[model samples]
Target chain A: MLRALRNHHGEPSVRRPLFSPVNLAKAIGALTVAILAGVLLSGGTFAYMNSTVALPSATIKAGSAALTTTGTPLVLTGLYPGQTQSAAFTINNTGIVPLVLNVSGVAAPAADANSLSAALTIRVDVTTAAAGCSILPGTAGWQGTFAATLPTANAPVSLNSTLAAGATATLCLSASLPPSAPSTVQGGTTKSFSVTIGGVQS
Target chain B: MTRSRILSSARSRIGVAVGLVAFLVLVGSGTAQATWTTLSSAQPATASATTASVLLSDISALNTTYNYTGTTSPLVIAPATLQNTGGAPLTYTLTETNTNATLAAKIAVWIWLQVSGSCGTTTVGTAGTLAAIPALPAGATSGTAGQSTVVCIATQLTGTILASSGSTLTANFTLTGKVGANWQGTDPSSITQSVFQAADVTNITCSTSGHGSNTTATVSWSLPAGATGASIYVGSTLVLPDTSTVSFTATKANVGSATSITIKANYASGVQSAGVVQALDSANGSGCG
Candidate 1:
């Protein structure tokens, strides 16, 4: 291995026309690359050549990207108490780091969002998660509905994957006046709730 | 012999040139290198009612009120500790509507009733400001719990609602946030005043003025079935209360329209008038004679 490296180290001791710029240049270039690679693999964050070779490592850990919305989670409103109404959901992250959220896991009705998800009983379906993670409020990605009653106890928070420090994520939520299904929903109604999003990364 | 040798030399030189050229480019690339990585997470709403965080509605800067509350329980419903929208003085208006518009006629309305807290010998309403809990740990007081929207609502004395007014009353809601204050948003209220129905009522009258000897007089009145009790007055002279219409009787010897009358309920003269007189007639018995 030592002898082989020597064979190609720096300029190869090739006897040829002394004026062959291409050949000489090639040899010099190869040597420079080999040496530079050795330096880079050692964790060179910058390419300052002779600068501080301080090999340092950094890690990004974001707090949970939490979300909050404007207005009551459950509203006792409609043409009547038992009247059908549409609603919207929003997501936000208040963290100092960026996070990726998988809306796939969020169950909701099909259509609108790139994926599908279903409604949860007595819940908005916005569950909590660790820092730097989140999911869009409803399925079909942006907006959807509970397709059921909205209770006051449950607190849904779709966390962003990585909450960039102090960054935020927002998703607008609107009431889903179901076009069809169930005896309670009345199929479809013009009644709707103004959906809003609020949140922060921890 | 010369051609062959020259070709061999040329091939070796080209090979070295190619390799060296590749190496040079690789080394130069290091001078300006950058990398980026993205991160993510997963979340979805299985249900609803995510956060109960108290959002301070009308934060009065000019009003500069130290505190505020929206219910009789005096539970601070806004700007909670470590939990606030962090805005300038805001406006919060509470509006009330008669949900039972059909039954709202003749109903009274009380405007501007708010939940207040105690600031040492102070009766809430306009004095004490409120927090979730004046105590530590930010505990919730009575007003914070319960779906009883009653305490949070205000009403006026029983007023005569006019059926001619369309049986419905709507309050336009608005909020003026105090300027130069810690808050700048308004918590506008879209309150609904649901109305409960009361049974229909009819006036009871004595058909006859006076009764002759052995004369049989018929007395009748109209009312919704739920008549718990009623009363009758015998001219300013006396009053009698009857629980059931079937057993009510007034068999006085002398009865006439000129006889004064007064009605009493639970001992006191209920809404009706006193000194009411009844007519005495021969065809029928006097009013309650």
Candidate 2:
């Protein structure tokens, strides 16, 4: 087009600069079209013909772990040497996940004049029987003096079984004083202690 | 320079966007792997032990000197108070050890509970004989703690005195308290005295047999002299009504889980001898047996 313009003007018209505003605009437009065409061709080559069926939205929820006890905080009174007192309680898995149970003992200061807590022994037994601790069917999980079995809170005795969600287990706790208990224990009163039940995700 | 600055800003923005995406990814993964734990509420357990004790007051009245003559029949000594000082109720057994065996055989010492009456009064009920005249005699109970029961001691001549002048009798009474199911140590309260003589002593002896897992036991006893009837007791309950028959069948349930069996000899003079206790075999488990 520039040559035709020069010929129409008869003599060689003054040559315009190669980067004039109009020329620059025309060059930029051409480059933009070329880049756009290249991008479309590449996208077409990589793309495959496909269809999507929306699946039911995937749903996810977290399971909870919890535990509860029935007839807790057993209080025993009028304990004497050569005597055994037993209490029955239930442990229920109150959450959605299975849980493992554990027990620990915390002995209070010896309130009795004779320190009867030292001579007291504790026994824990677990059973599936409906008659409860009266039918102590299984072997004892723990059997020893209170000082030995529950020396501290960190020391926990395992129930040795997993409880499924909503399942319940019956436990029997027996406290006894051997006949050989010291004579000083006679007339002693108010020796106290506590037992705790704990649970964790299995 | 302006174009170079534009390129630098674009690169910086891309780096920031990349970092933000990485942080979100990491956070998402951490939340998925977390563990869940739950514990039970604090459940408390408690226990306690009990003790037993006893106390005797006004014990000085028991020690006395008794002067006797040929015509002296029986002497009633001063009355003393037996108190249950311990926390629990207690039953007691009194055993008399006499230095003079001859005088002990001829003399009968009777300890009775004085109820609103003086010593030697016929209204007072006889608890039991202290001497070995009746084998295995059961003593009176002191009841609950802080309860007091007035006790009277009387010495009677069972037969005619052979030696008139120099005969002396010294009796030591040892009261032992049975606390709960077992006996604590002995509380020795002595009644030292010099006595004359007595007539033939009446004795009652009882034995229990055929007691085991079954509820029935065969109780047999030797009738005391001049006794027209006898009454048997397993505890406070009377199993056999007053009768002349020396041997009879009684229910072991009356004894419950207790092992003590006592029998009383009823005399025509309206006097009843102390209870003679016999221990039931351990084979008789507990309860009805």
Model 2 Cα lDDT, one tens digit per residue, A83-144: 67778877788888777777755455455666777777777766664776655545667677
lDDT tens digits, residue span B154-250, model 2: 6555433334223565666665555534435355555555532222223433344443555455656677566667777666777776878776554
* Reference-based lDDT, residue A3, model 1: 44
- Superposed by TM-score, candidate 1 places the C-alpha of residue A75 at a distance from the truth, in angstroms, of 36
| Per-model TM against the reference | 0.26, 0.45
What overall lDDT goes with each candidate model? 0.32, 0.58
* Model 1: per-residue Cα lDDT at residue B223: 40
lDDT of 1 by residue, B17-69 (tens): 66665666576655674322222232222222111112323322111111111
Give model 2's DockQ, 2 decimals. 0.18
